[model samples]
Target chain A: MTRYKAVIQYDGSDFLGYQIQATGRTVQEEIQKALTKMHKGQKTVVNASGRTDTGVHAKGQVIHWDSPFSIPVEGYYRGLETLTPDDIAIVSVEEVAADFHARYDVSGKEYRYFVKRSPQHDPFSRHYALRYPFDLDESLMNQAARILEGEHDFTSFCSARTDRESKVRNLYAIKIMPTEDGWIFSFSGSGFLYNMVRILVGALLYVGQKKLTPAEIKVALDKKDRTALVSRTAPPQALYLWEVFYEKDNKK
Target chain B: MTRYKAVIQYDGSDFLGYQIQATGRTVQEEIQKALTKMHKGQKTVVNASGRTDTGVHAKGQVIHWDSPFSIPVEGYYRGLETLTPDDIAIVSVEEVAADFHARYDVSGKEYRYFVKRSPQHDPFSRHYALRYPFDLDESLMNQAARILEGEHDFTSFCSARTDRESKVRNLYAIKIMPTEDGWIFSFSGSGFLYNMVRILVGALLYVGQKKLTPAEIKVALDKKDRTALVSRTAPPQALYLWEVFYEKDNKK
Candidate 1:
């Protein structure tokens, strides 16, 4: 079996999530269907580096799949491009060894959350940004974000639905940058539990609004209980999987 | 009656145009209906500087209306904010003299057209930009744009269906600026004939592709016949009424 790596981008507005589900449309299911059609009715399965939630976008999602046909790397991209919808684009495809597993080989991931603070709603940009009319103190938010970086037990920030045994993860960076009409919050981590980034964003927003102090975040972390933190989670629409990184010389 | 000047913005994807029409929803009809609702069954008439065709967006469209009630300018904005759908926004409302006319008092107008040259379509921005995959020489297009500046009879550029008798208008500026991922063409003029900007964009696109030379545009302009020029018109989705200018001392 030949393995290939694909770099993908998608507008997740209509997707249920990255995983296959019985009721709603999903990015994985659509790609699998497209691959099956391309392989002359043969079924194909793909493994992604991460499973993004519903309404979450991606710019550099990585995936790997085994195909029966030994087509050149460039041909795979062309095949996928022809089969996928206009909302999704495969930027790159490359041949790899059989051992390259998208999920197992992933080393880190980056995500960004966009907030639109304009008083008037921008109709064209409403889908991609979270509209918050109130002014946010970015400096305060940044200070809170600094406390989030580094290895910690992130139970308070993770969703209650997360099934992981250990809540410990190393948050590499959390940066806030001001945009023309809003702000962008970027987070990089070794791995994220369910709704971890969203909850972290919510906590930072609470601090930005002066409702919570930076020290309160540390208390929440120490508590290890989800209820210790803010109940609100940022909406999925404004969150985007920016990139995924892997160890050098990986099979795929 | 109190006159109010309103600055408006809208995503025109679902509208038939700025004018009220029998077939589909129009920006004018939507705002008028919203105003009527706010006034408790009293109809309100609004006059704009000009009409935009179906699928055209606007960022700073200016309009004026007279109302029987002396509502605060903020009240007008807030009322419209609640009444108008998510696609439209009344950015600001200010009281003006009774004599001010939206159409007649305008000194100049600015319009912009966005063209996406990338092969891949941006699904999120599909409704706001025109996607053209073919390679275009932007420099050649700009050279042709200079010829379009200044006062002239734009009979060839105007739509054949236009009812206006006067085809002459002063084009203050015609500029092509390169964006990060695409091209933005801007036109500022005293007035524009029906479909004039779209036709101008079409001609420039043709010139950029080398299908027609810069000299052919001048020839087409001199011919003063719609058929003499290429009939291609840019899609209305990419066009935006960017701004409107009026005399500072004008009462309304």
Candidate 2:
């Protein structure tokens, strides 16, 4: 079998999610269907670095698959581009070693959350950014984001549906940059739990609104309880999987 | 009765057109529905400067309507904002003279056509731009646009369905501005016929592609025949009703 890794980009507006479900359209299902057709009805499965929730876009998601036919990289890319839907694009593809598993070899991940602070909603960009009409104190949001950085138990910032036993994860950075309309929050970490990024953004926004203090956010992180968070989870449309980082040799 | 003139914006990706038809969703129907609800079930009619085809967006389309209630400007704006769909927005509104008519009193109009020159399709901006993968000669397009400018009979660039008795219109300017990705063609004229802007764009694109010479375009315009042109009409999704102008004293 020939193993190949690929970088992918997709607009998740109409997709159920990145994973295949019992019903509804999904990014994985589309990609797999394209692969099956290329393989002449042979089943083809793909593994990704992680699954993104519904309406969460991706600019540099990574995936890998083993193919029985050893085709050129350009041929594979062209074939997938012709078969898959327009919303999902294979940015680049390359051959990889047999043991280079897409999910298992992941080292770090980066996510971005976009918020539009314009008082009037932009109809064209409604599906791409979350509109926050009210004023937000950036200094307070930055302080709260600083407190959330570093290794800690993020149970209060994770979803209740997660089955992982350990809630501990190390966050390398949390940067907030202001744009013309609003702000973009960037989070880099070793790994994230289910709904972790959305929950963290929700907590930070509460801090910016002065409803919750930075000290309160620290206390909630220490509590290690999902119910401790008072803020509602942020919507999925504004979140994006920016990029995935692997070992130096495996980087693309 | 109080007459009001309003500037509007809408994302036309899901809309059938700007006019109310026998079936399908339309921007005008949505606005009129809001007005009827505000008038307590009484039907309210609205007249726009012009009609936009299916999937054509607008940044500054103008409309006028007469209302029985003389509410404050803010009240009317807020009511419309609350009642209309998220894709439509009321940018500004004001009471206009009773003698003013939205359709007949227009002095000029501006339209913008967006073309994406990138070889790859942008998944996020699929509805906002036309992706033209082939190389284009900007100078050639500009030469053709200049020839088409000024007062001329534009029968070659007009739709056959238009019933207007005269096709002679004075075009003030046709500017081709290069953007990061592609080019934006802006047309300013006294008025345009059905699909005039799209047809002009198609003919210019043909010039840029070297499929038709600039001299041939001049000949087609002089022929005053719709079938004289070889290029197809451009798609509607990339066209925008950029702005509408009125007499200096009636400007809002």
- Return the lDDT, model 1, position A154: 94
Candidate 2 i-RMS: 1.0
Please write out the lDDT profile of model 2 over residues B1-252, one tens digit for every residue. Answer: 989988899999999999999999999999999999998898999999999999999999999998898778898899999999999999988988887888899999999999999877678878898889988999999899889999999999999998999999989999999998898999999999889999999999999999999999999999999999999899999999999998856633
lDDT of 2 at A172: 93
* TM-score for chain B of each model, two decimals: 0.96, 0.97
Weakest ten-residue segment in model 1 chain B by summed lDDT: B118-127
Off by over 4 Å in 1: A23-25, B14-16, B20-25, B116-120, B131-139, B248-252
- The Cα local distance difference test for each model comes to 0.89, 0.92
RMSD per model, one decimal: 2.7, 1.9
Q: Tell me which residue pairs clash in candidate 2.
A: none
Give residue B208's error in model 1 in angstroms: 2.8
Clash counts for all predictions? 0, 0
TM-score versus the correct structure, for each prediction = 0.91, 0.95
